[model samples]
Target: MKLLVFAHRLELGGTQINAIDLAAFLRDRRGVDVTVHATEGPALELLRARGLPFIPAPDVRLHPSPARIRALRDTVCRVRPDIIQAWDWWQGLEAYCGVHLPEGVPLVITDMMMHLTRAMPRGVPTTFGFEGLRRQAEAAGWSRTALLPPPVDTEANAPGASDGAALRRRLNVGGDAVLLVSVSRLSEYMKSESIKRTIEVVRELGDTLPLTYLIVGDGAAMPRIRETAGRANAALGREAISLAGAMTDPRPAYAAADIVLGMGGSSLRGLAFGKPVVVTGEAGFARLFSPETAEGFIETGMFGHGAGGADNAALSGPIRALARSPDLRTALGAFGREFVVANHGIEVVGDTLLRVCRAAVGYRPGRVALTADAARTAYFYLRERRFRVASRDAVERG
Candidate 1:
């Protein structure tokens, strides 16, 4: 089947990267024809570089523009895809607004990476937030929302498969030092404050055990992070921190670390590599793996200390203990790796997504009869004309 994927950008973040990976996987494994459309940004260049089929979607904007929406609708009509899958909230809105599909064509929406419910509650601006998209989805009358977790490249991220010691040596890390790596953009919504606090706590723990903290991405808060690192280094009496600006390929950094201080997506990647990950954010959704439902192997702590913050005291003992014990790290990492391989591996996620897409395309909601109670509830609402009244009110308000 032909699939047209929509994403706001093709940048190296978890969502964009996963969309690309999914496209690649679907093409290679299922022989599905795939075309990626980016509304804006530099990710288009990366998509072209990867030899993926791409179109510049000019009307796809963060905000509404009727003219642009018309242009997008025309483009969708020309492509005539069997499935149009929106990667995130912005792309989802654009897909809902832009696509004028034939009767058989299906529209699928996915919240694959960051959860808006979690991010917005932590003070991220509504303009760039998922809450905005959630409102759009509700307003658009889209009933189905699928949760597509990011797919890790298991072949690359698997531990012991790569030479960890050699990677560490290449980074000039000493054999005696315990390395803690975090790979993410330094942004407030991403919990940069937690990272800074963690650094300070680690420094306070002191030089009794040599430690190295490597941050592997740059963003709006880089300067502040650097300034804080400088102060932290001086207080600790050693240059224990290195802020390596963003690298396209983070495999080397992931391979080198003894422990990973991940902030969500990076944490998931670390867990895929069988590393023990400590995550702090909105407790319900920011986790790498769902401890409650995940196959009983992966161990991750969901900190509820504050929204978008880590539990410093709870985390400190674990960090020190893991740094001191390689055996414990190995055990925990092994369990994590098992859980990731079984669930979040690309093939597994891809297959699940494929099934969802198929179901969506073939869906006939009317044909599936509801039980008596559900039918009665539907009848009550219909008789009261609640939906018609609400929709009229919404249109009038608009």
Candidate 2:
């Protein structure tokens, strides 16, 4: 099958990573031809590295104009794909409103942020990344949402030794110092304020314990992150924490770490590396994904939200425990890796997406449906953008 993978951006974040990983799977394992298309994002270097055929697009206008629609139509004409997979809401909106989806070609929208997708394009088949999102969509009268669990490249993230020793050396940390690594986009909104708080934890334990914190990836919150790192190091009078910025490959960081801290895809990637992961998210969601929390974590996509929020456990204790006991790290890491291999490897996820595509192809969308969807989405997009921006400003102020 010829497939066009549409991404919100080509940045170094979970959604982009997930899209590329699955696109790689389709091309390598499913005997499919894949082309990637993206709007703006900083991970252009990573995209070039993938060697996948790509088309760069301008950042999608929430309300796509005729020319924008023509661009998508032209790409579709050129690719003639059997399935067009959109990685998020805006991608789906652009495809649905801005261009003609060929009669037989299926447009599959994967909802990476379930709650944030309050205005998902109607009538387009959507794949939810977590069970929680799937349930919410279904309860809200959405019939097409299917759970597409996260997928990681098992081979790349296979159980490994400390090849990260070289990374540790490069970062100028002592060989014996316990390393805590995070490989996620450093943004306040999506990242659950974990990175900021982790800075505080590192400072709190700076003198008491010999440790190094390495943060990878970049975003809006980076200026603040860099400022905090600078302040923390100056206050400690040493390089206690370092920002590695963004890297195309996070495997080395995972390999070198004593423990990995992240939420969602980043946590899963750490688990894939056979590293112990402390899943962190918004609203007090910070806990290690052990055998006890495995089922719940998997079901909710490693994030606890709203009233179903986290246990609010003190994270340093878990990090300290993992740092102290190599045995525990090994045990927990092994368990986490096993969980990922069984449930989230590309083979499993790719097959599920392919099946959804096949099922979706038979349903043909009409002009009436498409027009209605476009109008509704445009209204929702404008209204939501205003509200979301205001809400974000309010949250930031608080």
Residues 76-191, model 2: lDDT tens digits: 88998887887666567667655534344578888777364666676778888888778887887565778898788888887663377789889887867888998877666857
Q: Model 1 over residues 1-398: C-alpha lDDT tens digits?
A: 88888765455565666777888889888888888876555455556666788877663222334544565566577787887776543444445445522243466766633323221111111111123334553444334544344577788677765676876776688988888888776665544665786677668675677788888877677889999899989988877888888767777787888888654356667877888766544322223233442432122222223442344565576677888888878877777777668766889879877887777666544423313323443354446443321110010000
Worst 10-residue lDDT window for candidate 2 reads 389-398
The segments of candidate 1 whose C-alpha lies over 4 angstroms from its true place after superposition are 39-46, 59-61, 65-71, 100-105, 113-147, 160-167, 282-311, 364-398
For all candidates in order, the CA lDDT equals 0.60, 0.75
Measured by lDDT, the strongest candidate is: 2
Estimated TM-score for each candidate: 0.76, 0.88
What value does the lDDT take at residue 108 in candidate 1? 72
lDDT of 1 at 65: 41
lDDT for predicted candidate 1 compared with the true structure:
0.60
